[model samples]
Every structure is written in structure tokens, then in C-alpha cells.
Target: MDYIQMRQKRFLIAAWAFMECLLFGGLLYGWGSLMYVFKHEGIYAELCNNNDQAALSAMTNSSSSVTDVTLTNSSEETKLSDSNFKGCPEQDSKFTLCFTIASALVCASSAVLGQINFMFGTRVTRLISMIIFVGGSLMLAFVSKEIPWLIFPGLSLLAAGGLPLLVTNTQVSNLFGKGSSSIVGLLCGGFDMSSAVQMVVKIAYESGISRQHSYYFLTALHSLVLVSTFIFLPKDFILNEEAMSTNIEVAGDVNVTTELPIELKERGDVVNEKTGGLKENNYEKKELPTLMSCVRQPLYIMHVFWLCILQLRFYYIIGTLNPYLNRVLNKDDKMVSHFTNICFYIMMGGLMSSFLTGVVYDWQKRCFASSRSSLRQNLMPAVLPLTIVSFLAVLLSALVLVPVQSLLYLIFIILTLFRSFLYSMAAAFLSAMFPSEYFGLLYGIMILCGGVFGFVQFALFTWAETYVEAPRHTDIFLLCLVLVSFLHPLYQWYRCSRAEKELTQ
Candidate 1:
């Protein structure tokens, strides 16, 4: 969260993600954005299901002349066709089965990693995750041509690294009291910004270089940063100033920064003041709060409820925005290119927000140090007004241009800026709601809620969007914003009251 001190790890994290994205993003997430290459070359697009007969069967459907090829194990003949078929939205119909099956398998790995993070100390887990992340990047750098091979390392490392990222934010929230929202926002914003930057790189490359070469080029380039991270990163964890500290003031009473601690055991590392070194204090573990227990607690419940609502809506709105632009805003090559640029800009803004979130959260902790014990009176008053004003402003400013094109473009730009800032709040604040121990789990729960609501929202909205089209789109987003901002205090008050009652009983 302390940008000047923590910038190295943050940069490595960003660079690591950028490479994974460049390779996989181009293939899947950014596939539509890079359609020309797939349409023309049919390179990795061919589906050769490792079996010789499956390859022969599919090939026979298209031709009599058999192209001789050696078949290996289950992975041998499996390959995607270069044909721009109607079935696959980006590649072809067969790819759907292949992608779905493979994605499911890799996601299983991610789920395992998620569980593992809760068991390890955050720093220890992060160290492991970083290794896995670096390994994944190296894999992508080497295996760009062999697409399936890329999946193994990509998902493996992604799963390994995912929890460490969330846990750090959770720790930040626990350490720094007030502006945790901003810090978490910064992380999320950085994520999206990285995506945006990758999109720009992808767009630029698609205009010139070959797809395989482009992916390889980006992967190799990003991996280059790993060297500096390894060299400069403190060999000893306790020696790192930022990592060891618990409190830092940013400005006035607006922000605070601190390091939250978690022990793998009941007693883990406790620092010796005299020596300025960490000494092992392993102790037997005690029972910790469960999800059910936490939910039954009032404060946690309120925190989760609002997070679910806001995060889901945000995800839903952004998800729909892309296709809506193409479908409604004139689906031309030029417009598509514009939308692509918007993606990059939005992400760039998010990247900047990631750093800013940490700074803002640090500031809030400084402001709220006096009332640290009172959950609502202490915490709510400071952030509630900002949250309300920001949301209302966002709603009013973002939607006004919906009915008009020139204004619409300007509104989109402003909306991107606000989204970067506000979304950072959503993430960091959620982390602030819990103690340090639950950081990874709590953050994951938030994302899980976002994911659930996200799916439902997309389904429902798409069904509704069949009839409703842009002005309606902007209107709905604005309406949701105003409503949430208006009602947050009442809802929060109720939740806070309920929590106090539960504790008393």
C-alpha cells in the first residue's frame, strides 16, 4: 500500500499478470478483438484431438487427401481448426467443448490453490505463488506455439498467485483502518488496467506481427522484469521496512497504512524489539471464526451484503458494456477499434488507481484512528458521505450522455475514471471489515458473491436487453447507483444494530 516502498513487488505482480494475459488474453479473452488473424491464417485454430483416428475423421470430413501426422498420447491429435466457423464465437464450435473441458480442469487447480492459501501465512504463500507465477510466464514464453501446453502453466500459476493478491489486501485492511477501500480498489483497478494495457499491445501487434510471434514476444518481455524483482527484493522478510510495519500516515485524518499479520500457527513470528529481528514463537492453534459464525455476526453480515450487491452490479454493467457498444453504437471496424482503445484506457486508469487506493486507504486510517473501536460511528461517518457523493455523481454524470453521442463519449471517459476510483473502494473497504486472519478467505468470499451475482445479472440483463437497448443501458446503471447511495446508511445502520444485538445476546 505504501507505493514508494512496495512498488517493486507491485510492479512484478503487474508485469507477471501482463504476460499471462498477453498469451491467453489474445487467444480467449481478446479473441474477438483479434479476429483478423484467426480468419486468415488458421494457425493454432485447428482442432486435432490427440487420437490419430479423431484427426483423420475430422480431416476426412473436409478432405480425402490425408495429411500424415504423428499421434502422441491423449494430447497427440487434438487440435483446433483454423476455419472461422459459426459455432465458435471466436474460434470454432469444437473449441467450445475443448475450452470448457480444459478450463474446468484448470479451474479445479485454482480451487485447490484457493483453499491452500487459507492454511499458510500470507507472506509464505505469496513467496510460493510468485515462484509459480514466474514459472507460468516462462512456460508461456516457451510454449506459445503449443497452445494446450500453455494452459497448464497459465492456470496453474494463476491459481497459485490469485489468493496471495487478495490476502495482501485483506492484511492491508486489517492493518490500516480507514482507507482500506482505496487500497483494495487500487489492486482491482491495476488488474483491469493491466488487462487494458495488454489489449493495447494485442491490438497494436495484430496490426503487424504474427499472433504466435506476438504472444512469445510479450511473454519474454514481461519475464525480463522477474530478474530485477529477485535481485532487489530483500533476502530476509523482517529486514523489509514496509513489510514489517503496522502503521503509516499519508495525509491529515484521511488515510492510514499498516501491515496486517497472520501466523500459520497459533504463535508464528514475533519481532524482537532489541534485536530488530523476528523470533519464532510457534504455539498451538486456537479455533478461528467460521463463515457461518462470521455471517451470524452483524458487522460481517452487513459488510458482505453491500459488497455482494455493489460488486455484482459493477461486474454486470461492465460485462454488458462491450457487446452493447458494438451492437448499438454502430458495429463498424472503426467503432470496434474505438471500443478496444477504451478498454486499454479504462485499464490504464485502473492500474493507476491500484497505487492510489493503497495511498487513500492509508490516509483514511490516519483520519479514523480516534474512533477505531466503534464500528459504525467511527468508520461509517467518514466513508459514508464520500461513498454517497461519489455514487450519485457517477450516476448523474455517466448517464447524461447516454441519449447523445458526443456527450456519451465524454461520459464514458469520466465514467472510466470514477469506476477506477470507486471500485478500488469496494475492494479495500471489504478487506477492512475483517481481522487479518480472514483476509484471503474474506476477499475470496467477496469475489465469489460478485461472481454469483455477475452470472445472474448477465443472464437477466441479456434477457431484458433483447428489448432494451444504449440510453436504457446508461439509465439502468445510473438508477442503480443513485438507489444504492441513497439507501446505504439505513441498510448499514440496520446491519450494525443487528450485529450489536447478536453480540449482547
Candidate 2:
């Protein structure tokens, strides 16, 4: 690819990343704040045509009667408050379930969309996702209790609209070669910073902006994404010849070839015999591994398992934070909002970590080349250190939960930053190990596993909260869970180190 094309690809990647950031902000992180509005703002009352008042009153009476009976029987004090009854009956549970189910649907659909991208190319896939997202937002904005089922479809479509996230990472890795790590970091950082988007929306809502206006704002943001996708994304989804050639290097007098799929070879792009470089069409052809073949690889399985574990904890933390703050820590609404606003700043730590990881990764590659050593042998130097830091951070975060209420803000900051750092490191690892053609499919599968594990994690936490009764005691069990989860990465690191030693000997 020429300079102009390279610049264009970079610009498109940035646009896509920004689009994903907005989508995530409005749909993923924004849901919690939206639910708060539904509860406190009379939005649900309007949706239910003011019938919610009668229902909430009846529920409150029933709750008081139950509390009276319990107190009389056990000789203990029980308190009930009007504030607790502020929201529509079951709104919290309804919204939480909607968010969880929507996330799973997004993962499953993204997996399918990955295959579609391979078949139809970037433009079609992006257009489909954009339409779904916009349509879903409109549905959400106008939905009422009469059409309660709309919540499922609306949230699901909005979540699925994140297909560009999968595509952009693959494209950046393909265009930038070894230097893609920092760029990928920037992309993922944009994603993590989506909490800021939600914060902005939340601020707007709290400052007397109507819910309908908030929905309109979201729709406008997604419209920008649609326009950017149409204008910036390339028509032909071909890998850059220069980036591909740079990826092919000589180490220890042996050529390291990054294979493309057989389909690209048939497109008239050919390798030059004399220069050992790609010629014609400014594209490089490489043979890619099929999805089935990828599933059969043990290391691939290990990588997916590690990712699932990471996400299990991540989703659980994010999902439970509001209740944990309000119920367990006794934080007020303003405090909760304040903490949420700071989340993106904490996530910025992950952005820095990811960029540093990329710089180190590229530097290691240069070192291998200069020393005439095998690049393949050093393909994953970043994994070990990243895993160690991630494991320690998780351990500390879990331990701090015992005193979490005392230092709630600090603990969350540390936890969010390190968890995000781990996520970026994992993405970089996959990009380095796999062919770009298969990255999307494989990433989708990883996300699918995460969704499955996340649901299981959510169920476990719900069970604990319902059956255990003591939040402090539950922290002990959660700590144990975090510890057990580390075993997967530790075992994988051991296996990889052993393999590297064997290769050296």
C-alpha cells in the first residue's frame, strides 16, 4: 500500500474506534445510569401510563406487612423506606436481566458477524451493525409497558451494533504490522473510556434533560458513526503489501512467513521469487487457518479460557457495583455518580499500560532481529509479565474487598485499571499469535466464552446474595473465587515457558 492508502486506513481505524467508544458508552455502561433514571425520574411511570403508582404502593404495603410480621416473630428491628420504593416494582431486576441477556446476544451475533465480514467484507458488515444499533435506540426511546418485549430486541440490537469493534482491531493489526500493539492499545483505550460517555449522558439526564432528549442524543451519535463508516471504510478488504512484507523477516537464517488465506492467493496477488516479497495489486497473500483448526489448538483453548476468566470477574464487578455501593457501602446517589464519573480516569491507567506493552513488544521484535534469533521463539514475551501483573492485581483487589467500604473509591480505581490493562494485553497477545483473517472469528469465540462465563458468574453472585445474607462473608468466597481463577493463567504460563525451553535446547 502507498502512503496515501496507509494514512487512509489509519484514519478509518480511528473513526471506527471512536464509533465503538460511543456505542459502548450509550449501550453498555450507560444502561446502569438509564436504569437509575427509570427508577427515580417517573420515566417508568409515564411508560406504564401512571399505573406504576398503584402497583408501587401495593408492593410497599406488602413489604411493610412482611417486615412487621418478621419483627414480631424474631424480636428484631426491621426498617423500610420510601426511597427504596422510589422505582417501579422490579425495574432493577428487569433492567439487569435485560442487560445480561443482551450482552450474550451480542457475543453470539458478533461471532456470526465475523464470518459475514469474511464473506461480504467490512462495508456490508458495518452497515448491518449500524442499522441494528440505530433501530434499537429508536425502539428503546419510544418503548412503553404496552410493548415491554421491545426492551429485549432493542437492547440486543444495540449491543450487536458493536461489530466494528471486532473489525477495527483486525484491520489495525493488519495495517501496522508489529507496531500495531500501541495502536490497538489506543483503540481499546477508547473503548474503556466509554465510561466517560455514560457519565456525560448521566450528567445530562440529572441536569433536567428529558429521557427522550437523551435518547435522541444517542441516536445522533450513532448517526455520525453511520456517516463515518460510509465515507472512511475501504471498499476492498485487502491487506497492505508493505505491512505484510515487513511482517516477513529473516531470523537465524530462516524465513518467518506470516501466512494468508488461500482465498487471497487466488485474487492475483503473488510472491516474488527474487525479492521474497509480494508483487502485483499491492497486496500480500497468506494462507489462514480455518476456525475449526483454531479450536483444536491447545494454546488457543488456553487463551480463550484465560479471557473467559478475566471477563467473568470484570462483568461481575461492573454489574454489581451499584447495589454494592448503595446497599452494602451506604453511599448516596451523588457519591455513586461521582465514583462512576471517575471510572474512565482509572481506565486511563490501562491505556498507558497497553501502549507501554506495545512499545516493549515491538522493541523485543527488533532485538530478536538484531541478534539473529528466531522471532517465532519470542513471539509472546509480553504475556508472562502481563499475566503476573494481572494476577497480582486481581488478588489484591479481591483482598481489599474486605475493607472495600472503607476505601471504596481507591479499591475500584486499582481494580478497574489493572483489569483493563489485562484486557488490552490479551488482545495484543491474540493479534500477535493469530493470522488477521482469523482474528475476528477467534475473538468473537473468546467473547462468546466470556458471555457464557459471565452469566454463570452473575448467577453465582445472585445465589450468594440471596442465600448468604452477610455481605462481608460473601467477600471471603469471592476472594477464593478470584484465587482459583488465577490457576488457568499460571498453568498456561508454565506450559509456554516449558515449550520455549524445549525449543531452545
Compute the lDDT for candidate 1: 0.44
lDDT of 1 by residue, 1-505 (tens): 2434444364454444333333232122232343333333442444422333543455556533433434559755433343311111223322222233322333343334445556654445555655665565455344434454464455345333433443443333322334445445545554445445345445655477645565456445545434423442222221123333333333444322222232211122344333323444544222344655554554445455555555444444443444445455553434545765664555455556455655765666665555323453334543553364356444644465354445545555555555555545555554454444454555555545544444445344445344535436545654555455434557655544554455557
- Compared with the true structure, all predictions reach lDDT values of 0.44, 0.58
* Model 2 CA lDDT for position 375: 27
Candidate 1 residues lying further than 4 Å off, grouped into runs, are 1-114, 122-189, 221-292, 351-368, 371-373, 376-378, 385-403, 464-489, 493-505
Worst 10 residues of 1 by lDDT: 257-266
Candidate 2 stretches greater than 4 Å from native: 1-4, 8-16, 19-26, 42-91, 143-149, 236-257, 260-286, 344-357, 360-376, 396-400, 403-406, 467-475, 485-492
